[model samples]
Target chain A: MQVTMCPERAIMEHVTSRWAVLVLQLLSNGEAWRFSELRRELEIVSEKMLTQTLRTLERDGFVHREVRPVIPPHVEYTLTPLGKGAANHLVALAQWIKANHPEVAQAQQHYDAS
Target chain B: MQVTMCPERAIMEHVTSRWAVLVLQLLSNGEAWRFSELRRELEIVSEKMLTQTLRTLERDGFVHREVRPVIPPHVEYTLTPLGKGAANHLVALAQWIKANHPEVAQAQQHYDAS
Candidate 1:
């Protein structure tokens, strides 16, 4: 399926993406995180998806990826100022969901019942 | 494909959805909008997607839908307080994207070049 690409559409899709938002939220709090570290932090994420999400975010300039020249190769990910701005909003959204999960759950139950 | 459903996951997906964030942001600024009015406001959205997004947001209690008994049917959508909270954050994210689109586009061009 060809997903039509528009600038607004792309940005919305990127930020609200399943793993992208979580990755941004995590990096926002931590400042920087290594690839494996991020994978471990978000246990449910697959390696492929994590890598893909990071690349997409990096391409969008919201994420900065630093590769360290080493024997084993180390990569670190952090947010750019633009990303930090996005992450700040994401954190607020995440916090809201965490704080109001109960009410949302109740509403969902009611919705399902009716 | 059956996507695994989790509350946090669902909430993130719902708010970050293509039309949902835009709709929430619009409602946040205007308080309430009729269905057709919203479609007119956001010229790119399809009626099916708009209704689907509204249903999802309503189920989550972030959006409140009011139905007025009239000849042609009048349904107005506004952010619930919970939704208002979410919208506040979404607006911040949207603003960031708008402000930074140029840089992001430049970055995408750079990425495509190499």
Candidate 2:
């Protein structure tokens, strides 16, 4: 990554963003995700935030947005090839966290008590 | 990870955050980092944000901040053992990005043209 180009950082952040990680993880199953489906999966995410996150991912090319022209205009999101790679790293990170949660919890308790 | 507790999400967000990832990655070398050294390393980070980031990580037990009394107080930050685990995952994510930058860049360019 060039130190001069913030664009790289910006793009990195897009995929690794708080909500983006979860979204990418969901889409990593190689399935097209409806906006509703994504919302249902990440229940804590607000509609506005989900919309923004999807748009940002779409703009960055990590997510492919498909809108079918019909009465309701079916909309779906899926990982682009690039997104799949990013999702792989994120899932690994999440798994790492889960495996190490007990140690981290102990550290947190130690810190809190100090 | 439980969906009910936002603290898990919040703590996860803290370590995975843009600045935190970089900071943790740097600290993974098992070297204590001074405030000035970290600032110089991450040139783009504002002092305010760095301070906040460090404090948060320290509170969360991911970082240990030490202040030594002297004519000029010596302050240093080091990653705890638990932090080492988090940093490992973050560095993996970063490495994955560098290795796959070409594909991602292509995707970005393709998206822009569309």
Candidate 3:
């Protein structure tokens, strides 16, 4: 199909963004994660970037964010049904990369050598 | 899983890169496409960007580039077996996005209204 700038492509870019993909994968376990927990899991992610990523996912309906009113607000993020569906595909892709990355690396080495 | 900068992540990035995803989707039909044909299909992609994207995919062993010696050098691109596997996952993700994007848009509208 001939391509143009479109919303679908934009959403795809969001879903497949580096942090978004990791967030989906982390949430795919069906457990809600506190923002700090998620941050800890993705240790290298900056606070600003993680917050932005979660907001994007939540806005896209792939994540549900709940804030409990307490002395310190307890915030949790979980995948919505739509998000789970997306995560399944992404996790499968991640698994495939994990399993077959050696071959890809080998190919890169060969290509670089030649 | 905590992700640091790693080969698997790098390969995943290449596979999911904007042009890579489009290229794989286009090649999923299993027909060999000439450079001009692909460039035409992805109308907005620059010739240089297309060349670079093809090289990256080619290096990853996801794309097979065959140059036929003729009056003019005829180069054709097709997905390798490995690439076909990756494309299936990406195409599924694309299909899911196509079907559910309306809901996502609605969610975005709802979120924005608040």
Interface RMSD after interface superposition, model 1: 7.3
Q: Mind giving the per-residue lDDT tens digits that candidate 2 earns over B26-89?
A: 8888898999998898988999999989987887778989897887899989998878877877
Candidate 2 ranges beyond 4 A from true positions? A1-5, A68-71, B1-5, B68-71
lDDT of 2 by residue, A30-107 (tens): 988899988887988899999999988887678899888888789989898878878887777777676766666777
Weakest lDDT window of 10 consecutive positions for candidate 2 chain A:
A1-10
Lowest lDDT sum, 10 consecutive residues, model 1 chain B, at B1-10
DockQ for candidate 1: 0.36
C-alpha lDDT of candidate 3 relative to the true structure:
0.88
The pairs that clash in candidate 3 are: none
Candidate 1: clashing pairs of residues: none
The candidate scoring highest on lDDT is 3
Predicted complex 3: CAPRI docking category: medium
Clashing residue pair totals per candidate (backbone < 3 A): 0, 0, 0
Higher-TM-score candidate of 1 and 3: 3
What lDDT does model 1 reach?
0.82
Interface RMSD values, listed in order for every candidate: 7.3, 3.6, 2.3
